[model samples]
Target: MTRLSHSKHNSLDEKDYIETLSQKRNTSKSRKVLEVKSAALAAAKQHGLNPWSKDSLILYMCCFTSFLCSCANGYDSSVMTAINIMPFYQTRFTSGVVGSTTGIIFSVYTIGGLTSPWIAGPITDRFGRRRGMLIGAIVICIGSAVISSSNTKGQFISGRFILGFGVSILTCAAPSYIVEVSPPQWRGRMTGLYNCGYFGGSIPAAAITLGTQKIKSDLSWRLPLIFQCVPAFVVICIVWFMPESPRWLLANKHDEEAHAFITRYHGGGDPSHPVVELEWHDFKEGIATDGADKRWYDYSELYKTTSSRWRFLMVVFMSIFGQFSGNGLGYFNTQIYAAVGYSNYKQFVLNLCSSIVSCIGALCGVAVADRLPRRTVLIAGTFASAVFLAINGALSARWASMPSDAKNLSVGQGAVAAYFLFNIVYSFAYTPLQAVYPVECLQTNARAKGMAMYGVIVNVFGFINQFAGPIALKNIQYNYVFIFVGWDCIETIIWYFFAVETMGKTLEELDEVFTSSYPPRAQIRKVVAIKDDGHVDLVKEA
Candidate 1:
């Protein structure tokens, strides 16, 4: 009996000791995290740029020029809608059923988007980010030149395809570069600047087209097509002068350069600084987790774990639904306005005004994206967009049924007004968050590939939206707008339940958010950590 009692006592003692050891181990981890953060704060105070620093503002300015790569995409998509109205363009190209031809021309860029990602992902991963962007810029310039000179439909379409190809690659390189390089606090806002760049280029696309419309030569249409080269050319010259992404530098074995880069740009020129160590540790952790070599055959790694798989799915859905959300209507607003008798110069003027409105909305999104729940902003944007689209569809259908004379009344104009409203809402809500969220969802090694995958998914729906819009206008008329309403309702539900919030996370920290076992519907997430700086770094919280 004494022996049995002694055995029980020994077992209980061992259990308690194990528990005590576990606590110590956990305590050690927490201590290390605090130490690193505290050290980083000290270093930032001594050497690094804070969120509101002037040096940080200069960096943002340089980055915006690089981001002008996306501006090419925005300009190209909308330019055709305006150019299609050119008598010279129509005289040379298809005159009858312009919608079908226009849709094909506009959507061919999506085809380029689809194919180029397979190339861009591997190239960017291998050659480095700066080189990848340079290649894209060169191609964009070449494609723009081609479009400007072409007189045949076949040549015209080829130029567009080439533009899409380069722009697709640019889209891949720019976002990942921006997310990787920018400070955690301003990432969303800077990313939100995509709309500003996009519409900034677009306003000119209309203004130039509208200005040249009175000119009596091919120069009227050709000048705008050639103008596409100017932004891309500017990007080429400016981006080469800027520093490469430090994350890419580190990943590609340029550790010394990476260290210096983070210090000079991110840490304010203190290599031994805590900000350097903190950001450095994140990449080290990412490299450790991404232990597998990034080979072409290793695409399976994207789904090797539950975290990656879910992340991949989230990115894919965001890309696909981004188009089908009826936001594509913004690209075709000139044609949409024409349905209400506001074609020609009036459409161009309105487009410029609305592009400015979208810029304002995008600014609003930038302001809030970092501050608010990502899912909430997305839901609000999508829901508000659906309301406007439904109203437009209803009004357009009623006008279509009335006598031809009635089509010019307030109700017809109301449909046009509704589309204009959708433009404002969609630009503000979807433009900034869409690209920002998907890029945040992906793993480091998989980001380029993930974006490549994004290119594929987004272009597929882009083609459908561009192709179907004009065809539906020709066949089903204004009622076609209803498709977006129903589709958006379904998307809103999926987004509310499934989307991960990624507002404040450093890109490296996001690996943990998607990997956590927490259900999506949980309202109050456990506080992960609050830095000494009090900057919110919540992964799921964002």
Candidate 2:
């Protein structure tokens, strides 16, 4: 009995010692986590900034030029709504084939869109971001001049294609450039500002098209197309005034340039301070672990791993979802109005109202995107858009089968209301998603490549959406388009399930968040440390 008691005591002592050691280990981990959290918060706070800072203001000014450049995107999509109803395009360009020619004119731009990302992404990564912007601006200006001078359909198509190439480069380059150079706290807001400029561009484009409907000159349609060149010219002139992406410079091993840029924007700072070194360390470590110079951007990398595969799939679907939301289909709203027995002048006025609502929606989205979690805003906006589209479809179905007498006043009102409501919601969601989500989910090394792939998917779907709009209208009634779009509510459900919230995450944090749930999660780790002077350093565990 004495021996047994002695053995039990020894066992209990062993258990106690083991428990104490476990507690110490856990305590150490907890302390480290706390330290990391505090450091990250301090650094973010230290680097916090306003969107109107001198550098940011310059970016915003460039955004305005980009905004004007973006008008061509909206104009290319929607200009045909009015032009199709015009006598010139109908009789001359289409050979009286309004539907087919209209689709061709709109869809041809996607040809350039498909090729632009591949060319732009690698080049932007190699050359400076400003150079890409400058080239795109110059090309677009030349294309616009060509557009203004074109008399034949072939010439018009070629000019539009060239213009699209320029727009694609600008679209892919500008936001990423803005986000990369911006302070983390204000990155979303600045990118949002870029989006706001884009929609603002649309408002004037639509207004000009409506304003010109009264003119009898051949310039009526051509002038709007030519007017797109104005922004390109502005962008070219402003390109010299803008700062290049500091992050891109760092990535290119331009350490001196990168430090100068960060100091210029971050206030009084020693360029070689510990904080700056920390930031550089974090950036370099992230690139090394995340796979830069990895087979020189192999396309197979997208599908080789589960995480990458999922990312590619998500971005592709997101791009397709954005296009399929039926916002672009509204480009053919004039046809819908005409089919409903409305006159051209009335449709023009109606489109202008829709444009105004879209602008308001885009601005609201820019405001809310920064305020709310990105995924939530996107989901809510998509849901709202789906609801509006459903209502429009119901209204269309009701009117399509209604007697001629009841259709006159009520159908027009319903159509206009549906168009207005949908634009407002879609714009709010679209403008930000286009800017924030892609940039947020990606890190710097793969950011350009990831976004390049995203751009490709967007243009692919955009091409299909633009091409299908006319065929769908020709084969079926106008109501079918809204019905098709309303079905995208299903996508809202998909988005909620798969989408990650990214409202206020740092670039490094975002990189971690993306890998958070992947297999071997413990194998992939993120380490970010900030020195007292506000330089940030990060490392990723392999």
Model 2: what TM-score?
0.83
Worst 10 residues of 1 by lDDT: 1-10
**Tens-digit per-residue lDDT, 1-542, candidate 1:** 00001112344443463344335334223211222212223334444366566657657866686568778877876677677777877888864334687788878878887889888888777776777778899999999989999989889889989998998888788887877777655677777675467776787787788788787888888999999988888887878767777877777777778777777777666554445655775665464323322565466647899988988888887887778888777667776777776757888887777677777777777777777878887788788889999999998777768887646578877987787788778877778876688878887788777887788888899888877777787887777788899988888888888888776556765665677785254232322233343221211222
Quote model 1's TM-score: 0.86
Top TM-score prediction, candidate number: 1
For all candidates in order, the CA lDDT equals 0.72, 0.65
Error of 1 at 468 (Å): 2.1
* Alpha-carbon shift of residue 52 in model 1 (angstroms): 7.5
The candidate that achieves the highest lDDT relative to the unseen native structure = 1
Pairs that collide in candidate 1 are 501-542, 502-542, 503-542
Our model 1 lands, by Cα RMSD against the true structure, at: 7.8
TM-score of each: 0.86, 0.83
Whole-model alpha-carbon lDDT for candidate 2: 0.65
